[model samples]
Target: MDSHTKSKDSAVCHEICQSHKNKVIKFFCTNHEFLGCKDCIALNHRKCQIDHIEDKCAGIGDSEEYKTTLIELEQKIKAVDAVIKKATLQDKEVDSTYDHVIKEIVKFRKEINDRLDQLQKQILADAEKKKPEDKETVKKVLERCTDLSSDIKNFKSKLQENKTSQQDGQLYIMIKQAKSKLNMDDLKNAEECLEQTDTLCTFERNKELENILTTHNAFGMLKPFATPMTPGKKSVSVKLTDKGEINIKTQSDRNGCQITDCAELSSTKLLLADYNNCKLKVVDTQIKAVVEEKALNSAPWCIAVLPEDKIAVTVPDKKKILVMAIAGKFSIIRRIPVKGDCRGITYRQDHLYVLCLGSKCVLTVDTHGKVKNIISLKNEIFVNPYYVLLSEDARYFYISNQGSESVVVVTLQGDISAVYKHKDLSAPLGMMMLDDGSLLVCCYCNNTIHHTSGDLNEGQTILDSGLQNPWAIYYNHQDQEVYIGGYCNQLKIRKVASTV
Candidate 1:
């Protein structure tokens, strides 16, 4: 036989199982799509139904299953090709789109400059119109004053002269000219013009507009986001699954527990910052109990987790940040004192982002407690940002503003990307990004938990009745549960039930 005929014969032959060198592979598990010998089937897939190899292979290449699979493969290929084409077009248009935006900015700047020029011309013209009248009035008054001044000198000289009626005549003529021009209109107008204080075409600049430009880096916001290329399917709505609540109140706590903030150590464990009682407690979410508790000299407002069992907590009253290691118990490693009343805090990569409620700004600090950058929020839509959160990708921040009752989205480059405001969302507090990439916000005044997309759209109240003034909310995607604490004594644990 030729070499090709020999290769075809070799391919058609059956092989022995690797598990048992002496035994030929005789069975196939259709459910698991695995081939095995008698010994292998008994040990590995005893529960799975087995088919004889020859009988399973009797599909003869024209079966319904094979035809269906071929059609599905072809459809998938077409779908992938369409996605590829769309992505190519999008990539090609990026530069042109950005160029157009640059042109628009240039156009806007020209318009502003033209308007400023027009305004400058108008004010200058007004000053020009008033200049001649004021100048003439002053000149007339100066001339009269000069004549009188010369008269006094002339009178003095004439007194010194031996004998001169000519000197007296000269003084009399000077006084006559001075008195002739001293009319009521001339005197009043001169006095009024000289006594007037400033307001001569002075510009009262808009302090608010100046502040907006000074505080912010740019006028136009450049937002970059990712969208899945897979063909259409809408979002799956979700609700809080009612697991029983955990009462965080302790014997040492004289007042009701104020859970100002919380952090997830794991899917089933959490660390709670009890602001009212000035305590930090670790809780087991699965068992629904407090695992451990630690007392603090000052109230802890927020938590930022660092690598290697380390965490940073912001103490607003002390104006300090405590770096603690939680390997055994929460023990302070170092104290970093900040300038303002730093409340809400989070960290990404090498920097800590702490929100200054009083200053209306955020401070970015390195792991070693050195300040890196200060992001001012004076010009943003939100008035009082009590809480700040860094996005998972570390590209953006979500700030909860109590004064404006809104959530402002900020990029890491310190730009306001979007502002979320709802008529019902009043005095918004803490926020957590859910597993589904939706955001859950605490409406402190409304007594509701609002869920919305990352851009804060298509929102609905996911939890309203259970929690009261839900201040601290934490979510873990692994367990898909929410651990919430608020103004009350009890800390809550709720499951997230998703429905597609």
Candidate 2:
């Protein structure tokens, strides 16, 4: 027998090795089957029963054979790496899809706004034109009636002098006949004149306006929503109402992100921060339109607008705040590098207070980007401060901290007065003071808008649902509409229930 041959009666070597081999071992057969170890082929060896070792071996060895195995493994690793890279590219594709959807929705809104604006001007012109026609009709009738009255008075005076002459009688009969003809014409023109009466006037007829209000479906706009518009299998429809429990006029997909900030300029105009998309979208309320949108170079964490139409946005990633005009033009007015993550920003008079997402300090800056004051509240409870709003008098600022789940009322002099807390308060992103001194808080997690009286008590829910992630809430005094912004399956603008 060869030196490598094993006897048939030899006992199996089952002894544990001194050390486990560092290099992996593999085996293959003539049938093209492969396995990791000699142990896997023990049955095949038993069936062969020849006990031939080197002669029957397929030439698998520990030198170039092992090296070849390693090369195969490296190729497999490369294939797996390619797969991982493809997955990463897929994530970017998802992001781009969301971005495109958001842009399309915004574009739709702009078209609606433009159409509504043109329609509003047209309505005004129509009223102006109809006004003259109606006025002329009224003037003609009034003049004819006046003449009839004067003629009757003269006929009565003539009759009093003596027996009425044939000519006087004829004239009296003719005047009476003329009056009858005028009455007949007035009867024929009643409906047209009434229709013209309304068109000639500029008064807003709630019912008439409601009838003429364009009918729109929010389904298409909400197609890109991050969440199911309807929570369950039940069909959901958002409709416009004159004065109902909920008035849902506009909706747009947030493109799968939640809203972070919202500000209402009028009943027909709003400013929104599409946080995930790094975009600032402007919407029209009256026509449910998007007027303009600007893409931020970095993430737009917060936005504030001045009375002069200038806008300021803070980007945490960029570590700087940008100032831009409403025209979407950036101006190098002020560049603020915050010490921590800048979360919230608001303008009061000539000063700006920035809320830090990482610190408890409120940064105050002037119009020239000069650091004017830093208000530090000694409260250790607040870990992350989000949104800040100033009182109408500019004497106090309200800061909502997500970490503490509390809203802190602070003075311009760095004085703390009150702390409002609710069991449900999670991340209060947006806070607004209503005209009647009520406060509207955007509870992000709950997807609801909470309303509270001046003292922060008697909390009532104005809107409870239909929002994916409401980040901001703004009230437009001109149109009496509330604007909500943040992630909602997509970016969206909705008209709040308002009396005006």
lDDT top scorer: 1
- Tell me each candidate's TM-score: 0.54, 0.47
State the lDDT of candidate 1 residue by residue for 86-161, as single tens digits. 5665564465456546766787788788987998899888888788876776677678657656766665565456
CA lDDT, every model vs. true structure: 0.78, 0.63
Off by over 4 Å in 2: 1-255, 265-267, 328-333, 489-500
Where does candidate 2 have its weakest 10-residue lDDT segment? 227-236
In model 1, the runs with Cα more than 4 Å from the true position are: 1-235
lDDT of 1 at 285: 71
lDDT of 1: 0.78
